[model samples]
Target: MSPNVKSNLRVASASGSVTDRRHAFADLAKNEDVHFIVGDWMSEYNMTTRGGGKVDSNGGSEEFETSFTEAFLPALPYLESKNIKVAVNAGASDTKKLYDLVVREIRARELNLNVAWVGGDEIFDVVKKAAADGSDFRSLTTGKLLSEWECDPIYAQCYLGGFGIAEAFKRGANIVLCGRVADASPTIGCAAYYFGWKREEFDKLAHAFVAGHFIECSTYVTGGNFSGFKSLPSPALSLGFPIVEMEASGEFEVTMQQDRDGIVTVETCKAQLLYEIQGPYYYNSDVVAILDKIKIKQVGTNRVRVTNVGSIKPPPTTKVGLTAKGGFQAEAHYFVCGLDIEEKAAMLESQVRVALDETKYHCLKFRVNGRCPEDPYTQDAATVDVRIFAQSRDESALSINNFFRPVTDTIMQSYPGATFAVDARQAIAKPYYEYWVTLLPQSSVKHVCYIPSKGLEISIPPPTDTQDFLYEQETYETNAPIDLTALNPTTRAPLGNVVHARSGDKGSDCNVGFFVRNADEWDWLRSLLTVEKVRTLLGGDDTGKPIFRFELPNIWAVHFLLKDHLDRGVASSSTYDVLGKNLAEYLRSKWVDIPNKFLDRGRI
Candidate 1:
């Protein structure tokens, strides 16, 4: 560590994703009193390709996230004027390409900023060669081999650690562009560089990782997408960006400006911490965070102190994501209004199945999205959509004549009040990507940091120390059978009346995390909310899917991880909630018997 360690470092999270506020970086540099800024632009939901492949809303051209150009171009001079350091993974598929774009702009502006780009994220060709050598590429979620996948793999991008970013900062690079680095890596890199922490400094590195995780989503830690969003006086859309005031001891505080919207409290911090995490052990390429013992408390208005985060060495394997064409999918909706909704949906599904010759396609399904009320006032309320969806490898099966004609031709034959919620023009088959999450050895990554001004490329090797991570989650149960009658003064109501939840997708797996407001409710939560109870709450939709339960006692939370729940994942999911974001709300809506005493305390 440095002799004169940085007393305090102020770091801000600029943009959460491609769709986040375009003026975030500029606004921060011009208005905020921060020394460093980081942004994460890559997401599993959006698939970007290298070279002349995909160039659309999903991703940017030149093999990187071009959407960042407009957002960043105006912020460059502001960065020069304010002298703030930046690190972002906006170089989606191509790091060098985006690096050149930034360098050209810097040259034109005559700014003193030294630019750098990180490499080793793109490993498509390497994996392809390894697959040919009879190496196993089994999925982390399904345990299915890559050979078993029906489609050909097009791209593979590995998530790198923060060491490369640290090296870039050490090499005098004022601005760094990265490809597919982990979301929290930016914060970790900034803190490591500022505080002179080594890669083996597991405790400090892990603490930085937690801070990175909290603020990486920009407004997430600032009340955006919160279950208690209505409690905030300001609208959820106008949330202030997050800031982490980190100290040399690895202690940090999460807060945002009060002038803007959003609140930074213990609950919002806990909510963001639990988002997208599968278990108590949160992994990164550099370090693994032991989250069960972490502490978060409100120190002042819009400020929360976080401490006691535990850590261990990184795992030998890192997460690798590959995108492949999963054939074509299309959907058409027929509205069944008024009475006989079930019979109408059933009749239409049976008619369409035969008409479309569903046997020719990979999979065809008829699903009733919403229910028609028994006695409704409006036609919309009395309507339910019977969706006819199909996926097929053979393009002919999804063609307009074959796929569209079958559903449209059945209008006259369908039951009463049959109409199309989806039009004919939108029913044409569109290509979707299937994202696969798998583990790759860290040794496979030849991580490097390139500083263009200095003409230097520093090799950042993989960590030597690692622990064999246990994928299993912690389990807690009653030692003996207890009397349900003792606490039996209960009332049947929606679980949301007493609990709050946040759910998100992780490839084929879905995590629905539920929490309470205080420790009093925590006792009732951990006892009553079990895997079996959660399965029942899912209403048999998960079927035979395995649901794993775990608890975060410090946060008064219980998490349920459902394996293979999203089928092929968000990009190619057949379900209506493609990202599985609504799973939490769905679980919250399920009826649960709450004790009258606990109910009297006030709802979450």
Candidate 2:
């Protein structure tokens, strides 16, 4: 049977985590009209940690293969009954192994499911050759060349697009597995395949791109991990994964399973849209999506329609993630409570400095968490955790027993109310990785889809319109501040009291975007929140880092990007919020002047 080109394409995301979400996948299986199901089982942290290990001959990791078996085998019967095609990037480091596993499971059940695998995103050899040829693989975060890196990369993988998966579906495959493709690529591929969208349909592709981005994180657009959780429906535990009803004209409606415990509204859709986006131009390997003019409207109960998405030319190069063994890291935490907490913390720090030599470690940090209240109601209120962490290339320097003995020796002579947070001996040293993100030419990547039954292999090439690799930094002039005296009365409150924000990490940098509910608030937001204002809000966290601010008029949002703020990315960063997930909440807690007029209009 030929696939329909004019019908609405219904694509749903089943799982978002690296581990199995049996309930979510079950929810997907129960749906009747879902044309396709997608899952994202890989994250940047997962790539750096689990993806660094050795690969078997079939190019699969034991960890991901186990996860795939546990998550998918149970749902296979249901998926086959529904005749739903599956597209997932769960293969991670090993697509072939996953493909083989799926085929074996289907054959044992006497099912006729056609499984395909997409490969060639792995580019360790290409990166090696480029580095050897004196190619300056400059770091996207630090601007340092690859040659300057101290550690050798264990693996390097470029992000592939969805066209290859689309090709696999075109060749009559029921399941398509991929490695290291963009998270949204699965939805993009499914939509393109169903709608017969041409490669040159930039506008349609842009719409699918945004739709894919929204649902890519599974329940994100359906109220999971949302800031306004209180505003959502009750029983958020059984939140449903997202589904997009994509039209042939590039418009889509975001919805979720009616039986689930989540709601889809304009607020949730807007929040997910702002998550992890850098600026107006969101660059994907296939298309550069323009987000400044995006529009979201609540069309019905638990349904939001997104439209007006734009796109520019696709970049010639895709981002390559390189993970290398950094060194061993170890840390221990101590608690100081009751009166004179600051004095006690200082005394403990002094004792540690005198007991241990700082020169033995490559990186050392003494961080204090929680503030000592001036007038405490309880001991816990006045307690603060002091953590000491050290990392080094030398294994002995980070050893649990040797490195902590000096700190333990001071317990007898330590300050008042000093105590270890937990058993100090439980702290163990473990190897970490340095994430080096750079760009690789798209042409250097070989994208191929393999269909075992048909004994076919298809090659997917880069788009002909691909341009040369270019990095253009967007610059915006600071808009003049609104005259508070000239306007109506105002009240001093936390910026979040009147604004909605979402934040995420991009390598070592963090991006925080603030959106307003109405035009009046947007005027105030655009005028009030500048790069300088953002730095002020960040306070000591800013550390004089380079900050860039951009304005999106259509969404009434302001976005700020702070560079080198997350230390050395998630894997090697010593900070508690390594992924920068809490950065927006922290900013929302900072007080800002809000115009009384906007607040009176129920903008908050």
Candidate 3:
């Protein structure tokens, strides 16, 4: 995709309130030029709930769609008036219900409406059908249904892709609804149909994919939860919706609601572009897109247009998103200070362990961190906290209350500084469980077809080699090696760069990391920074375990078990998580335009 494409058409971008998302449709209906309606809905967790827990269904429940429905339902009348096509992935968990509701609305209005529902990505149906077919579920990954990882037979469904909607469009569905389709697919399907783009034109498809990444999260492009968010003209009302005007050549101009609140500055767009998304190669489904060297044109107020986008061959397969159970554990922490810290801490821990004996829980665990008086980080800190966190499904609460409750008693009867902290009256208990699952790429699974649009006979070439794929531009350098000296020896960490970026709450914990292009690049970087070099330089026993891991081929880089690394854990615990989080911010700040500066900088 290139930034030079010209799109003179006037598109309607609407915003009102959640209750009037449908009424907002009046803007579309009133505008004769409006051809399509796109809705944004989803969150970082992809789950609707504000907090975490075992939910009723795989993708939370349909009830979670309440906000979306309140906003989307009223749009039905306007959609009928314009004969415009509507596409949204708001189906979420009970997508079928949403789909049925929309279809019913269209029909009851005597509207000539076509609706298609996209589901099956939830994996619930796939697991069930496999069971009915007596096929192993793992075969989805191995191309043979080998059931290596057992799934809740009732919960798994085949991962669905966007191509199915092309088929829906072909079948005369003006409205498309889906569950768990790749985010980029929605934008790609619209562009592919509008421009008569073929699949072999992987470059344009990839460019559209990047465009989707920018605008898919709705308010994200308009400064919602953005880094360094500033005073907005009207955050309390008139929230914006993103708009992408694409030309036949696959280039697009990204903008937000015209005449809406807030300034659509390049900085706002760039900040959104740089949010959690690591760069050079932006990715989704199996497609890896190169965004470096792509041009951004500020052609109009509130319009930061894009063009000259590039694409690469899709991976040989798709990654499945499945959730499964791991195990269970619990943790509780307390603050303590006073003299003979280590000794008092030991006594406190012993007392807690004895409490566990009084209350039988499946498994109990404990740890104590002692503070020295001379430690610079802690002034006059001659203290020891006997933190007791226990793990077990049954009777775990009994152990925590029994063990840590006596700390107050100790302050009055035996320990010093015990009175310094807040009341130890309440014992905080956090329940835990393991969530582990892997994805199987769509290429590995068998599917019936890739549907085309109505009145459009689209021909997608069979999978081909690199030389045959069509891309708008090429700018990626071959993967480079990582420098080892940049990391700390004892901690095996790279000294993070100083950054001026901040997102979310000041103290809120975040999971942030940069994503490279592919597994090949990751492996190359790992080999370049050999364990011997890292261990020798950092002085830490290099088990060579990467604190960071990449979900390969999909090209997502991950830093797991990071809560503690960012200083959200026990005090005096090196505060590495804090450093790691800062390191992520530093990388983002330093490399906004220079694609691989981190690789070139030799050290952190």
- Counted clashes in each candidate structure: 0, 1, 36
As a TM-score, model 2 comes out at 0.95
lDDT of 2: 0.82
Write candidate 3's Cα lDDT for 287-363 as tens digits: 56765556555688778776766677765444343443322333445455654666666655565554355344444
Where model 3 places Cα greater than 4 Å from the true spot, the runs are 1-34, 43-64, 107-112, 124-154, 157-159, 231-238, 276-279, 326-437, 441-604
| lDDT, residue 121, candidate 1 | 87
RMSD of each: 2.4, 2.2, 10.0
The positional error of residue 253 in candidate 3, measured at the CA in angstroms, is 1.4
Q: Score candidate 3 by TM-score against the native.
A: 0.60
Once fitted onto the true fold, the runs of candidate 1 whose alpha carbons sit more than 4 angstroms away are 1-4, 48-61, 471-484
Estimate the TM-score of every prediction.
0.95, 0.95, 0.60
Which of the two candidates, 2 or 3, achieves a greater TM-score against the reference? Answer: 2
lDDT (Cα atoms) of all candidates against the true structure: 0.83, 0.82, 0.47
Candidate 2 deviant stretches above 4 angstroms: 1-4, 55-65, 374-377, 477-481, 598-604
| Local lDDT at 385 for model 1 | 75
